[model samples]
Target chain A: MSERIVVDPITRIEGHLRIEAQMKGNRIEQAYSSGTMVRGIETILKGRDPRDAWAYAQRICGVCTLVHGIASIRAVEDALNYDIPKNAQLIRNLMIGAQYIHDHVMHFYHLHALDWVDVVSALKADPQATAELAQSLSSWPNSSPGYFADTRRRLADFVESGQLGIFANGYWGHPEYKLPPEANLMAVAHYLEALAWQREVVKLHTIFGGKNPHPNFLVGGVASPIDLNSDSAINARRLSQVQDVISRMRQFVDQVYLPDTLAIASFYKEWFKRGEGLGNFLCYGDLPATNMRDRDSFLFPPGVILDRDLSRVHEIDMHDKAQIQEYVAHSWYNYSTGKETGLHPYDGETQLDYTGPEPPFKQLQVEDPYSWIKSPRWRDKAMEVGPLSRVLLLYASGHEPTRELARFALAKLDLPIIALFSTLGRTAARTLESKLLADAMQGWFDDLVSNIKRGDTRTFNEALWDPSTWPETCQGAGFMEAPRGALGHWVVIRNGKIANYQAVVPSTWNAGPRDASGQSGAYEAALQDQHTLVDSSQPLEILRTIHSFDPCIACAVHLADEAGDELIKIQISG
Target chain B: MNALKSIPVLVEAPATRDFCYQNTLPLLHEISHALRRLQQEQLPTTIDLNAIPFGPGDEQRLLEFLGRGEVSAHLEALGNSSVWESGYPGIWFIEHRNESGERVAFQMEITTLPAILATHPDDIAESLSSLQKALENPSLGHRIGD
Candidate 1:
């Protein structure tokens, strides 16, 4: 009997996402990934100031707050051919570096770790054994038995109260939880430590951009002002604080995050064989050098890997209309032309035509438009993005640190190179990327301080402040290697206003619905491949693969209120 | 450390009437008190947003006042639900919806971690039974649970 197991709202990751898998025996024969919410933030941007687009775009998702803001500014900057000051570039790099490290760490310990670690099982773990295990992993100072004991006590308290708190809703005691009690306790300890650590780390953004979530950004440069002595501006004191944040970030990633990932990953080596979706990977490389135009200067090189080919890399031209397109066939959206045809971002149309069944329906009409996420394709193929893609691109392009870390992780895990293609590999890739970025952040930070000392402190260019100097119309794309994947924001500026705006974020590329060609997106494809549910009811196996993508449906779609009003004014104006 | 000590305090964005929702002030106060209780007792509680009748203005004010923290999650497992941490620690906003993607439930889960995040034991037990049955009868085509 083929049973359909639905894990709607797969918890922990960002945003609302529903996964329905059809099982033949215990193996998943087919799967459907759906974004249940609809947030047409781009529509609100129409007729708004292009300079102010970042402020609005940044609201797209709270978790990936700064990525959208950065991408929006880049889109406007790219459209105007604006060149920012060197100080601005360095600060931007520092800000982005902070985001990658912060976001990736949170995802690991808080979001994705629960799939492997059994929290309830931690109650039985001996603090001494956990300390021994932690010490064996790395010299991370928090490996003392006392630390583990405190974490255990807190867990016991939460358990005794019958309120598991965040540990609630977890599949405790499931047969799939392979980690021992000691390992779980250690992971739980780090998870608590990370919550506190992140609070201090976000101070970097506040010091530089004046606030954390959705920091102020400007076209042609960053919004942060530079003053060596002024207390209010980016002064010497703030600079040192930024330095402090960087050192702390590096320590946490190297000591806690990387070591914990390897330690926990050793237990789930078989995961390296599961969840290899759409072997194609794409990366619009980020962390630029002196010149943003020069792709060769990017620390993480931009390229595409087709069919698991490590020998070659493909160029991704953002301007090439034939290269990237979005399909709305199986999505709750409609193109101006029709639902069957695809449209590039330059001509992207968002007509929210939700054709799915009304609420309270047990199962989605899988044969129809069931998801709000439009299927995005590169050259008519589903490509997986995020840390795995960036890491692979870095490795394929001979980026030294990426290759070293990837090789080191593979060696430490005793897994083959082919293992990098699976669920565990994807999670490990995020940790590895965090380490690489943490190291690279020092160079960017040092360069910024040196530039300031050498008497170059200009942060923004007022040259492009006036719209009258611009042409009547222009279109450009801004993309970055966001923590999740390749996030691109395209803008068509006309008459000094945002005429058309479309943001193809990371989750859209990875978590989108099936395209017109009926090819499943990364999440669906990965879930369908070699996924055998040990317990159809528990479905830990399904969550393992989907969560590996660190699925962020909030980035893909937006909040659909009670009105069931799907279309947010699909005004397709030429 | 000397340089840091002399640094001027950064000013926050001024409270403007443009974003304030006066009607929700009472509710905001209630939420504030709840948050205080959460801190004082280390007790987790749920504030069902759906239970309170809110106008559009009230909703806007609640969001502006609460702001957002670093972490948020959308769980589409059994239903569509959003779990976002508010600006305050231990204050989380959760919105759960049915299949049509309408908010069937909205809550402000005040806890160390939102209770909805962990899979309940009953759910696992039910799932275990379902899997056992599925294993016992692979040819049974009927849907087990709605």
Candidate 2:
């Protein structure tokens, strides 16, 4: 007999995601991933000024704030054939790089580490033994017996006081937990350290974008002005601050995050064998060294790797209508043509149709339309998008650093190249990429400083600032490799106003339900791949694979209205 | 050259704009639930303020309604943190800042005493050991006061 296990409102993530697995005994036979929330940011964006779209689109998610703004601005720029100054490119690179490092570090410690590390078990750890274990891994200055002792006591108090607070509801003593008590203690200590480290690094975004979450963005360039003498601009003091943040970021990645990931992986080597869902990966490259138009200058190359083939990387063109399309077959949406047909984002339509069962129900009607997220397929194939995809793409593209880091980590864990497809590989890849981006940030900072030294202080190109200069009808696609994976925004502007705007975010590619032809999305397939429930109620195994993708359902699904009148209303009490 | 003088005054004055989404009521309801839990079960609850989005003047309104209590404290660690009790007993507000003086976390902890205000047992043990060492060595004894 087969039983259905449901994990709803998956905690410690940005938005609501529900996972249901059909199991035969201990192993999962089939899995269904559903995004329950609807976000109609695209509907809210219709007929708005193309240049001002970034400000509104930036509100799609609080976590991946800068990515939507970047994609939105790039779409407008692409539509208008706008060109920004070289200084602007370098500054944008720094900002994007900062987002990756800050985001990945935060995800590893705060979001994903609990799946592997048992917090309650840390109380049993000897402080001296933990200190020795931490020292053997890395010379992170705080590796003293006293420090570990202090951390252990604090954790013990919190656990003993019956106020687990954030640590409550965790699968504490699950048999699936493989880490030793000392390792758990060490990981818990570093988790606290990462919280402090992340705050300092995000100051880079504030220095450049003039804020952290929902930073200011420009259509033709960055909003920051480069004036060495002025305090308000990207002056000498601010540039130095940027440099400081980069160094701090690099230090943490090298000393703490990377070492800790490897330490944790060594204990759980079996994880690399499972969670290798659909072997296909996709990346719409980002961090252009020169201009957005010049694809050759991109640090992370854009391409598709099908069947885990590192031999030949297929090219991806966002502008090609047939290349990228979204399917609404199993989604709570409708395509104007038909539910079976896929539409390119430029012609993408957001129609509010909820065919799923009403709320407060027992089980979702899995045979019918079950999810709010539309299944985005590249050339009608489900491809995984995230750190693992980017790392594989970089390694296949012959990026020397990624190749070396992958080799080093594989050698340390004594795992083969095929292991990169599994859940642990996905988590480790995030740490590796953080190191890569942190190092690349320094070079971008240097280039920006040199550009200013050469007396090229221009950050914005005023050529396309005037709306009157634009063509009457134009459409373009803007894409970037966000912290999660590939993020793209499509825009059609007619008479200086947005005619159509659609964003195919990272989560949509990974967390969408099965398609029309009965193809499983990334999350569903990965869950079906050798996942067993030790305790069906405590589905720690499911969380491990899903969190590896770092699902952001809010970015995937947008709000919709049946009447198309009032999209959302906020009730106020005076 | 004074760098401060070069900054242009971009705004003439603070714009009086109405922020439509008032989150104060829901937050107050949450506080009420926590207060009830404290009264009935004697279990403390901490609401992470960072997790909740505050509209324009919503935070100010909530704080004003909570009012101020007699107890407040300042603590320095990786950065500075502030803790204070609200007019309603057992409702405490805590704000943690980073070294750059940026607010990293804020919470409305409903308890008799905020957790950070209490000294850790490990720290107390370390203090005892260090004091014992100082007493044992007359030369190092003066350094304790210093």
**Candidate 1: Cα lDDT at A246:** 88
Candidate 2 residue lDDT tens string, B16-111 = 422346567777888999999999999999999888888534676678778999999999888899999999989999999986578989999998
Question: Global lDDT of each model?
Answer: 0.84, 0.86
- Chain B of candidate 2 achieves a TM-score of 0.79
lDDT at A573, model 2 = 15
Q: What is the lDDT of residue A143 in candidate 1?
A: 83
Interface Cα RMSD, each model: 12.0, 9.5
Q: Model 2 lDDT vs. the true structure? A: 0.86
Clashing pairs in 2: A38-A558, A38-A559, A39-A557, A39-A558, A39-A559, A40-A558, A40-A559
DockQ of 1: 0.04
Q: Once model 1 is optimally superposed onto the true structure by TM-score, how far is the C-alpha of residue A21 displaced, in angstroms?
A: 0.5
RMSD of candidates 1 onward, in order: 15.5, 11.7
